[model samples]
Target: MAFFDDLSHIGFSTKDFYKSTELYEKLGFELIDQEDNLGSKVNFYQINDLILEVYEDKTNSENGAINHFAIATDEIDKTFAHVKKLGFELIDDKIMHLPFFEHGISYFNFYGPNHETIEVCQKNKE
Candidate 1:
């Protein structure tokens, strides 16, 4: 079986999250999800199967650099355990949850060999 289902989304940390999201909207990306918590705001826009996650980060001066990329999984818990068994370092202590998509999503991140962030996530089914 495949470890991941598909490419979920690409995330960007920007100094002006609203501006970036607005630009994407004007380009025909439809806003699909948004959330605000812990003083951080994130917005998701989709064009077909491609999703773009934009979040505010005043400290991030680089406006367009990719913060991370996510791979979708149907079994996030099993995937988390398997990745740890393979000795991949976990970025989060445990799986994290977000009120995203329909029923929400569970996710976690690990650092690649080059220090790039890669997230594995599963969108819950209602």
Candidate 2:
């Protein structure tokens, strides 16, 4: 049996959809579509296979319970460099090889707009 199919998407909250869209676009995300009727402050973005949702709700705190999200890339350095060029804050200067489950992975974390942490990881080959 297949343990899992794949990650379809992850939802994240934001105070302003337009601002969040701008931030994500700077970080290499493309604006796919949005629902203006849903509310004045709700929208979504599609970055490759990832679907990021941003919602505007003053009642909800912007702390974002979801601390971080990650993307797997074959060219980690190139991807990291592109992100840096976009002016996003790199949290750690050094990449780390973390041992998890039955294998090890190399990754680095960075801060995105809205104080959200984003991780880029490359899995080690056996």
lDDT score for residue 61 of model 1: 51
lDDT of each: 0.75, 0.75
Clashing pairs in 2: none
For residue 39, model 2's alpha carbon misses the true position, in angstroms, by: 2.7
Q: Please count the clashing residue pairs in each candidate, in the order shown.
A: 0, 0
Give the Å error, residue 83, model 2: 1.8
Please give, for residues 14-122, the per-residue lDDT of candidate 1 as tens digits.
6766666655665456999999857989998887788877777778655246656676789899878877776765799799999999899999998643334768889
- Per-model TM-score, in order, reads 0.50, 0.80
For model 2 the local lDDT of residue 118 reads 88
Give the top-scoring candidate (TM-score).
2
Tens digits of per-residue lDDT for model 2 on 1-126? 898887877777765556677887777677776765455565677777888777665565756547899988877778877877777788978777889646788888888666778899988775
